[model samples]
Target: MAGLYTDQLKLGLDDVGWVFAIEQSGSIVGALLGFWLTPRVSWRPLIVGAAFLAAVANAFTANVDGFAALAALRFASGLGMMVATLVSACLLARSPNPDRAFGAGLTLNCLLNAVFVWLMAKLLAESGYAAAILSAAGLFGLILVLGLALSGDLRGDFEAPPATPESGAVRLAAARTGLAGLVLFGLAINMIWVFLERVGLSNGLQAGDLGNAFALGLLAGTAGSAIPFVVGDSGNRARMIAITTAGLVAGIALAWWATDYWTFVAAVAILASVWNMGLAYYMAMTAENDPTGRYTRAIYIAVVAAQAAGPAIAASLLEFSHIGTVFAISPLPAIFALLLVAAVAGAPRVEGSSLAR
Candidate 1:
């Protein structure tokens, strides 16, 4: 949603990062609280409550005129969304086939996000920013209702016994590496994603055209997610990450240089697809490595923190450097993430099994 209306939200690029940062601050806080409380508290009421909070925040978001007021409301909405998101992540981590589960979840999410993007784009065109925000609030309200229907007594599975002290230490180390990798990944992706619509507009594309491109890109993302579900756990996860990372890099480069409409569309689609595919694998790897889901919980924190930092970093960079420089530098974090993932993949096995699943 931020992507859809970021240009219309304000006139300049100078302070745009603050909007994302403030929202992410709330996300990080909510994720931390959700991670701490999820194990001890029942999920049903927590999810319902969080969804309600987000709905209210989003509902009032359009009324604010100042960046400070908008940021505060976005913060509140982030809190609600992050709580529900973390709960869902924890649930997915507990699945018997975490890879497939995560993949399927990503596929579904991407498809839904695409649909919402189209709807929001139309709402923004027809009504205004207020309607777009209100639509998001309405969606959250629907999510609240769905949470109620899906609510039940849920618990994590204990398939394997708790790790020994040494094993726990090893897992913790690996998990930290994975978390760092994820932070870098988030930074790379969000830096481009938050600015993509603006990039298109600057490149001579219409708002409607950009919206359509985004919708198509999201559909491609759905396919990317589906690939992991189709391949399941038997495929080489590390190799998959490397391939998707390469694709993402190429896509970013194309977007940087794209002069034609079709070129931009293709670049956007590839970028969206590879980003979704890469993260699905990353999340699955995190869940697989940490049986207790603590590492998985940390994934959201790293992601939110990176999201807060990425756009701010990009915005600051724009003060001195060209947008092309921003795009060129974007892939550096992803490359570092790839290397970290490779290192985790190569770490010595414990109990005759690789530390990373």
Candidate 2:
């Protein structure tokens, strides 16, 4: 949408929201679809296809002259990327260990996106939006080749666990219990994510400096997650989650209030590390209870839906709040999520679950 905003396409309000929806439609749809399936039905091919198509579609955007054409391309891009995301999620679920699975996934995603963004910035600097798109096309083409080689119709290795169909009453009760807490968690996390970059810019940080903040934060978080993978059991996962959420609350507040680069970076790193650790722990919990594969898919649906909606929900709150106020407000949701982690801990674990499964 930003690209279209600066292009001959001359996009406006729709571009900001609707166009984004269109462009990421594939990821949105594919993730939901992926959650509905089991490990044996891996969506890798769909994801692979999506990546290749996204590049092709992006490359062709240069030829588009008006809003309508741009919209079409954006919609196509959405379709492609969503499939890729869905594939990734399916893979995540199939991991024998959720925390380890998530740690690896986070690392891979961060590294790839970091490289991709660096290339994009370089391309944009040298040749503008069109060149950036072309550069992405080349990257996507490379992804397609690798995907084709490693995943020749072998994407569906995971299988859904058997369903012991519960009554509607039992299921609705479960959902009612979970809905509020999940929304709160999403809002809290996204609030931190969306505004962190802006905070850096507001503090007189140079262009692209925020990337370093994310890199450091994620690395710290990964290191923390590694500790649990080496020693902890599911019994103490809730405490870890609570501690991490508290850290996120404190980190966000400090980042909003702090002035120096060291202070801000320190806050960012703490926020990144603990928040991701919380996520890994929480995801592990979800996987534990999802032995039938059906429940696991549903959990993924909640997570993916949250991922799609969190930023928009956070942005809406920013309309009436100052930066400090907004940053402070996010803790409410983090607190709520911490409570959920505690409550969900009381739920039973289903055996033989995979993060990618």
lDDT of candidate 2 over 20-40, digit per residue (tens): 666556556655656554355
lDDT of 2 at 150: 53
> Over 4 Å off in model 2, which ranges?
1-14, 24-26, 36-44, 126-129, 149-183, 197-235, 298-300, 307-325, 346-357
Candidate 1: C-alpha RMSD after superposition? 3.5
* lDDT per residue (tens digit) for residues 269-297 in model 1: 88877877777777877777776667787
RMSD of 2: 5.0
RMSD in Å for all candidates: 3.5, 5.0
lDDT for 69 in candidate 2 is 76
- Model 1, runs deviating above 4 Å: 1-21, 60-72, 121-133, 149-152, 155-167, 195-208, 316-320, 352-354
155 in model 1: Cα distance from truth in Å?
Answer: 5.5
